[model samples]
Target: MYILIRYAALSGKRTATLFPDTPVAVACSLLFKFVLNVFYGTIVVENEHYIPKNGEPVIVCSNHVNSLTDALLLVTSVSSKKRNFLRLTAKDSQFGRKTFSSWLIENAGTLPIQRRKEHGDQADNSTTMDKLLTALSEGDAICLFPEGMSRFHPTMAPLKTGVARIVSDVLTRNRDNPEFAVTLLTCSLTYVHRWSFRSDVLVSFNPPLKLTVKDTPSLISTPDKPVDFEAIKSLTTFMHAQLSSNTIDSPSWDLVRVAKTAARIYVPLGTRMRLGDWVRVVARFVEGLAKPVEGTGAGTGGEGVAIERQGMKRTAYQDQLNALGLKDDRIRQSITLSRIKILWRLFLRICQTCLFLAIAAPGLFLWVPVFATTTYKSEQLKRSGPVWDTHDEVAQTKLVYGLASGIFVWLTAIILTTPIFGLGLFFTIWFVPAWMWLTLRWTEDLIAAFRAAVALYRLLWVSKADLKRLRETREDLHGRVMNVATEVLGLPKDPEAEFLVVEGEEGDDQPSRWAKHQRGRTRGGWDSALRYFSIRRRRKRDWNETLRWFDATEFPKE
Candidate 1:
């Protein structure tokens, strides 16, 4: 144990000192990359070219959303062969804890800031500042969450002045050095479903902003006048403006949720919208609603009342569906299903579900403990903690506890199996984690397929009258939402026309030989399995195509 501790300390020191292209840094990056990839189903990095390649000081400023995940994402995503590791500033208490977390932080190249007086003194602050300046002077990349605290807010909090101060100090000290240059790069992290397992994350990096002596001359303070209040304030305001523009922020998530629901129906059925695009559309809609119209009293009072009424109506509709024993998927199918193909699709789904269930049995048993612990702990936290009181805290507890439980369970399994495996313990431990991850992914897919099948069955077998009513209600809701979207977003009357475009010619609709083979395959009695896999691939391809079209035509280039 003593030797292990000493080795950990040595490893931490090496990790801290290693350059980006070094074996240690490369290995750490790969480890973090794998972990993040497993944690998120999809991670889309926008404007990756914006990351500066040449050896020059760069500060990456991002909004704090997910606690440790935010920092990890930034570190792993920004890769460079010329530069060393991206240094980060973390709370001093994290380092002082003398636990596994401290070891992790030290190895991750985190510069600790004193938060509590008891944990860190004046000297510690000075030391941290000096280290930051030294790192900047050496042309290393530094990442800091200017908001200082990670919260579950839809928007960024008012940024603290620490980042601005660091920049100013670095500039002031390096003013005499002719080669001194630093750039501020703003990054935004948007999660489709933050707390949900296998959710998508979008990381966007804005163009780097270079600060010259001419930009903020007040930062050039003399020895007698060390504090440059004006420079600090100006720099902070500038950073906030740049960061906020890149980030999506709203006063209320409830309003945003309402807008998102309304926006969903505006798009074509089976068309998958990018999460980032959906967020921007909702934010813009809310902004338009909040604007004071000349003839109409449609500012805060009118818009707020409208959204509240819409929320209540949606609740009522959900309750009505619940009374009919229909869930979201069932309602969706009921609304979107074509009358002609419904029976055929339902038959196909039934066959597919049987095959899916047969394959999913092993995964179901393997991942049950993970799911049970996560669900139970999440519910417990929601009920007992402050997570229930505020939107910011809603998923925070669940994410924390869920991650802890997963690690603990995996470790426990490894330990228990070690006695039996003995010499093969290492291999068993490695295989188990991979198996667990696969089990989780399989279970999720299985559950989704089962739910879709059940929804189709409900549409066909039970409550035809209720299904018809639900479809009518959905139509009404869609019409209302379209009207609002048309007025606010200036969308064309036929929004589907805007999204759907011919790839080649109107007559070129025939499927290729490979496509036909994929559609009609029954080898090893897995025709249904093949079809399910094809559907998944098709959906992903369609979604990517939709995003590409939007980027090309709908959204303006940055």
Candidate 2:
């Protein structure tokens, strides 16, 4: 079964004449599911309703963070009922590849985009533009990374003029067709651990910006007009604002880390935050910490403390976190548990991990070669060039090489055992991928559990004194952050208060209306009931309000 599945995936035979209209859509969906479920863990999508399902052509624009992974996630996760034909724009160089990757690209229906850096001054995108225009005219969906390239940048790179130009050209040509409306949809992809296997990914789709001929009267005055450069520039700025609002656009990677750590620490106990909510909190931190403006005079003895200065202080706090080799969650756990209890928990966790390891031993043994091959190949790719050096690129290279190596391992195993086992090899081959999956699952859990346990053990034993000091430091830092948030971001006095509205999750507790409702109306047993109660007691804040500070239009003057 595994071999057949692999064969089907690797086959070069074409199916549908149009890209996504055939089995390719199903293949893409399955591929996405495999990646998100097997390669990664806990995929969350927010504002999925924003994905237009009315069959109107839409251009999906996203920040390029995870190389090809970004494109895959955007195309797969954001779907329209009327149109699942999502074509992606890739660099022209990638389209010419004759390898397995090129086959995958062909099946995916990707349009080749020209980049000046690669093609130099002679780069031509006329053919690609024609195809894109035709697709959009037929109400197809197109995904493009406005950044042109993918990297682990602290914030989005300056968006290319291509997105704006595409929008302009599409709207200008279709101005007379009142039925033709091209919408620009912004998708924000946030990976909790970019390069790590089984890391979490949050895909947040912002509300679509509908561009009708009527909406852009200035740019689409005449349908016969050539590409409007001024319209493209204006629209690009607008695109920047839309993307910035939907993404965590920190000024630097260090500041991004600082913001994330601050958010992790700031989230109140018993409150669960998905990556979407967490990013909004982080965005608030970035807005507060990125700029060096006068702090509210109330915090620092008549003189105001600039948020940028506060950010500097927090940098040291983040450094402390790194030095202690503990996450804010671990610190919080330590603060609540006695040292003896911590030791007990650590011992149990270790024993639990050992049990998992024992169960997963056979799978791990079989897959070790595949993993090693992928690692070696990915490392080589990292040393290849600057383009392949980013964490996401390495991950993507691993995905490619890992798939290739796994097939090689399987074929070799079958060849070796077929003579002795004969027909039995077919039955046993299924166990290969199955066990490998089990091992991968075990490994993911093992790493997370063991890391926390080790960190806890170290806090209780190795760096015993640092625990208390770190706790105090974290508390002090948390308090200072709250003050700055309240003063600088104009947050409420109790910003972390229950009933605070946030991104993804919103709405305050309905104390007045709860008495009018009955639990019998709900389904899904105790779990659903508990979830209902949890949400009822939960406080949410409109994270959009705080995140607006990072909007490109509102960027503070230096």
Candidate 3:
């Protein structure tokens, strides 16, 4: 069921609230579920127990990545617990827009915060803070993105101080009452192929940081205390550190790629890691790569030179693998398989892919137009300007635009076919989504199986000399990665041991942890390198924009 249930305080009364148990709300909730589930193939929630089940108030602090969808996902994922409906804080500009989305957002109990940069002289969040304070006082869960704005980056931007100030305000008010307490929950969101439709999502909730007067001595001086600057700053720092622990906080996209490659190769043979576990291992690699090795001259440009050398090594290794028509996992796996077994696996994979292709053809026929339209729209927006070109805006357009297109397409189909199949058109509502969901699943399976088959086919054609040289290089790189992990980051020596360190429940089923790597290029060597550089240039620009909220001194000036 698609339910959009929320309760927030507005002028001392509950406004535009939808109770979870109401019939209309249930239907809406189901529709909501369908939309989210269709857009994302898998939604995994980790440390769900961190959400209070006893109906205590909570301030849900999350890292922003996917624009408006972040709050919606948090509500869907965490609202199941025994708490009052989760309220949200949205940008003031959204509430001011004369659009259906803005109307829907306001009615859904989202308070609007005025941002100084965006709102200029009109920026004033005092009213928003007052509403949030009132809601929390009435025992409601409040969700806000401390990053202030949404953007896609390997690491989180420096958080805004507003959330900490709110927390401090709440703590100060309840300082004298031992019975009163509020929970500060940190949620880390990770996506696989973030901008791609039907990709996987990981919503990880770290254990809640409880705020009780007994534990918070700094806020105990007075009941009517003004917002303490030092306390807010400290709390923001603490929250960032806590949230960082749960995220893959790589210094750059290049490091993220290298870390992922290392994790894929270092995984033990004959074992598959779940997405959550895979993320954990990748985070470990990122941490290692971003840190300086012992005896490296700290802050003397030596550390940067070392990191640059490692990045170059990673890029060269990837280029070599691309040239050989192989990936890190494939090269690691091909060694364990016999020639006959390889051929047999390839044959089976091809057969399976063909079966899926047949099953998915109908859905593909129906949905391809919608997909194409959304893709075209996304490209148009990207070329429009830097504002739309950021990863966040591109993804937001795909989802928002795709949702609108799907509805239009469905309604248009019903209108066109009603003459021939009057009542049958009604059934299309359920049938289309159900069949489209099935088709999408099979389509993914078909693509994966076909890629596996091709990789196996290419395996038999690789010369022994090239394969041997690639293996040696792979081993050398893997060793260097392990040294970083062990000596610098102080992770366990065994990569396998770190796999299951993530404490959380698994999703529907564990898919293979291997990510799609850049396909090998047999020709156009110079062209490939040039293309890579061009993409990097674009990404560097995107990264700089993503960190716009941070001070110039916080991160390297790019």
Best by TM-score: 2
Residue-wise C-alpha lDDT for candidate 3, range 1-558, written one tens digit per residue: 011236322223432332323444334334445566667655667667568853477898888877767766777776443453577767767766776456555555455667777878978878767777776766777788888778656678899897877877776667667777888999888875566665567788877888887777675456465555787788899889878876688778777777767666666421234556666667877887777555568666557547643753455787666555555767776678888998999999999989988888978877887788878987886567563226565655666667777888778776777777768678776677666666766666676677668778888898888778878877777776666555555556665743432222222233223322111111133434563322111111111012111111121122
| Per-prediction backbone clash count | 0, 7, 9
lDDT of 1 by residue, 304-389 (tens): 44663354335445445445544444566555667557777767766766775676677566566666776776566456635313
- In candidate 3, stretches whose alpha carbon ends up further than 4 angstroms from where it belongs are 1-30, 96-100, 174-178, 214-217, 220-227, 268-271, 296-315, 337-341, 387-389, 416-426, 497-558
Candidates in order, TM-scores: namely 0.72, 0.79, 0.79
Candidate 3: Cα lDDT at 231: 74
In model 2, where do residues sit more than 4 Å from their true spots?
Answer: 1-29, 80-82, 221-230, 268-271, 294-315, 387-392, 410-426, 462-465, 490-558
Estimate the TM-score for candidate 3. 0.79
Candidate 1 residue pairs in backbone clash: none
Please, what is the whole-model Cα lDDT of each candidate in the order they appear?
0.57, 0.61, 0.63
The 10 consecutive residues of candidate 1 with the worst lDDT sum are 1-10
Clashing pairs for predicted structure model 2, backbone only:
499-539, 500-540, 500-541, 501-540, 501-541, 501-542, 502-541
What is residue 184's positional error in candidate 1, in angstroms?
Answer: 1.3
Candidate 3, residue 508: lDDT: 24
